[model samples]
Target: MEALRVIVDPPAADGGRRVWVGHETVGLAYCRADVLDFLRRAGLDPERVRLEDAEQIEWHGGGPGSWGARE
Candidate 1:
């Protein structure tokens, strides 16, 4: 098993995904911009970090497209 630095958990009942940076839970992101905001507040540069980067983001149940429940 490997430790995920940026983990985006499966969507919740409220159609939001839990964004985790390291061991801290940033917030529940409902959209791509929300996720970006979490990363920005975590000290990650938005210009350098991309949401499509698989190596940088670990998406669980579903990727960015799956926000309104697990598909």
Candidate 2:
């Protein structure tokens, strides 16, 4: 599976603190609902969170030699 990063910031009512997503800045509205839900469940604020690498790493599991089989 692939992943994408989006910075998040706290809402004005919550003091509106600056949040970083690996040095990048993002708005609160862009945050995902599922992420916010998890944060709330974990007693964390979604605004001050950083999303892991926006870029995806190549999966080499399907390539030759990956399965450890003999030719």
Candidate 3:
């Protein structure tokens, strides 16, 4: 199978990030687990996917450590 193109947008005013898989926007994720859930719901295995892998996920603005502006 082809690789999944995952893009996590910058945190919004509410600290939620928009998750995109390929050309579809899955949903807004507030935390790491939320992102995993989005992937899981998309028919991807959460355990097999690595959030830290740049080749797997394109995290904009900041990585998992970043959430809100206050952080």
Best by TM-score: 3
Clashing pairs in 3: none
Clashes of 2: 0
Model 2, 1-71: lDDT tens digits are: 32333333333343232333334433232223544554444444556543342331111222111222222
What's the distance in Å from true for residue 36, model 2?
2.2
Q: Candidates ranked by lDDT, best first?
A: 3, 1, 2
Each model's lDDT comes to 0.86, 0.34, 0.92
From the highest TM-score down, the ranking of the candidates is: 3, 1, 2
**Number of colliding residue pairs in each model:** 0, 0, 0
TM-score of 1: 0.86
- Candidate 1 clash pair list: none
Stretches of candidate 2 off by over 4 Å are 1-31, 53-71
TM-score, candidate number 2: 0.26
TM-score of each prediction: 0.86, 0.26, 0.93
Q: Write the per-residue lDDT of candidate 1 for residues 1-47, one digit (tens) a residue.
A: 55448999988897899999999999999998899999999988767
As a whole number from 0 to 100, the lDDT of residue 2 in candidate 2 is 25
